[model samples]
Target: MKKDKHIDPYKHVAFIYPDIMDFVDYKWWAKYIYSITVNHLKKSPSVLELGAGNCKMAAYLSEDYKDYIASDISLSMLSGSVCKINKVCCDMTALPFNKKFDLIFSAFDSINYLTSKAKLQTLFQQVYSNLTDEGIFAFDAALINNSYKLQKVAETSGNFNGIKYYRKSKFYPVSRIHKNIFRIYFSDKVITEIHTQKIFEFETYFEVAEKCNLYVADCLKAFTYRKAKATSDRVQFIMKRKT
Candidate 1:
C-alpha cells in the first residue's frame, strides 16, 4: 500500500517554524522523562530519538545518557538543529538502527504523522526491535479532546530574522484531525503549506504499544511528570519492551 501524503506539508513548513521548537522547555521535559524512566528502570544509558526535528531535547537528554542518536525524516529540519549529534535520515516507521538503545523516544507529536493503524504498528515494531531487553520507548501524542479548545482562536503570526510565518489551525472532530496552514512570507517570495495530523485517544496508544510487545510503564501529562488526566492536551507515555 502507498503511504499517506499528509506529511508533505510538514516537510515544507518545517523550515518556517524551525525556531518554534525553542519554545519548548527541554530541560524540564528531559528531567521528567529521566525521572520516570529511572524510577521504573535505572540510570541513563544509550538513547535514540526518532523524528527529533530541529529540537534540543535529545541534546539535553544526552547529558545523562552515554550516547544519543537523533534521526529525522527531514534533513533540512535536522540541519537547523544545534548539537554535536549523530544525525541520521530515516523514516520513523522503518528505523535504520539495530538493537542499540536503552531508550527510544520522540516528541512534539511527531508520531501523529503516521496517521494510520498499520503505520503506527510498523513504527512500534521498529522501536521494539531496536530496543534492548527492558529498554523503554517514550513518545507523545496530541489528544482529540483538546482540539476544540483552540478552535475559535484567531490566526497567530510570528517572524524569525528574515522569515515571517502566519499560522492557522482547524480541527475536525469526526476524524480527530488537526489541519494547520502555515503561510511563510520570505524576503522575495510567499509560500503556503498545510500540515495535518491525526489525534488519538489515550487508550489507543496503549493498545498500539501492546501489539508491539511494549507495555505501558507510565503515562504523564505533557511537560510534567504528573499523572495524566482525561483532559490533558498532550499525553506522554513510557513503555518498556517485555523480554
Candidate 2:
C-alpha cells in the first residue's frame, strides 16, 4: 500500500489487476489480515478502513460491522473493488470524517507510507480525534528488518496484460526509508514510480501515541499472537483513544 506523491501505483495498472491479484494470492492475504484484525474488534462496531485498497478486507468483513467505510486516496482503485462497502476516496493523513468511528484500521503496512515521524504523529492525532470513546486504531509497520531484506532482494520483474514491468528496491539506512521503484513499459511510453515507506522504531510509536492522546493497547507481531519487539520484522500496533 505504499505510494508516490500520494498516488496509488495500482491505479495505473488497475485494468490488469485481476491477474496481478491472482499471482499475489490476494484472497488469502485479505482473509489472513481479516482474521488477525477482527479478533481485536468489538461486535458490530462502526468501521473505517484507512487504506482500503481494492476493499479486500472489507469484502470479507463489512457484513460484521454496524456500518463500514472503505477509503483510499485513489478513486480508481476504490472503484475497482467488488464489495458492498461504502467507498470513500480520501487521504489517510488528513481524514475528513465528522462522525466518530468505533474502529479504524489499515493493514499491509499502509502506515509505513507516512515516511516520517512527524507524519506518523499527525496521522495518529487525526485518528485519535476521529475515534469514538473506546475506539480502537489498529495499523501495522514494516521495520528496518524488512527494509534490509527488501534492499538485498535481486531485481524482480513481471508482465501484466502484455505490458512489462520491473521492480527494484533500495533502503536508505540514514533515513530509515525504503523505496520500491517500478518501471512500466506501456504501449506508447514508459513510466516510473517510486513508492516510499519509513521504518519507525518501536518506542517512537508509543511516544507519538502518548502525545496524541492515544494509548498503546497492544503490540503484536503481524500474522501471529506473539508480542512484538524492536527486532520483529513487522509489528501491528493497536491503540485506543483516551476516554
Winning model by lDDT:
2
Pairs that collide in candidate 1 are none
Estimate the overall C-alpha local distance difference test score of candidate 1.
0.79
Sliding window of 10 residues with minimal summed lDDT for model 1: 4-13
Relative to the true structure, candidate 1 reaches a TM of: 0.89
Error of 1 at 9 (Å): 5.2
lDDT of 1 by residue, 81-136 (tens): 78887888788887877556888888888888877878889999998889888778
Clashes of each: 0, 0
For residues 1-243, what per-residue lDDT tens digits would candidate 2 score against the true structure? 856566565666555445545555546655665666576667777888998877767776675564899998877778888887688998888998899988899988989888788898899989988998878888888988878876667487788778888878888888887887778888998888777788888789999999998998888987687999899999988899876
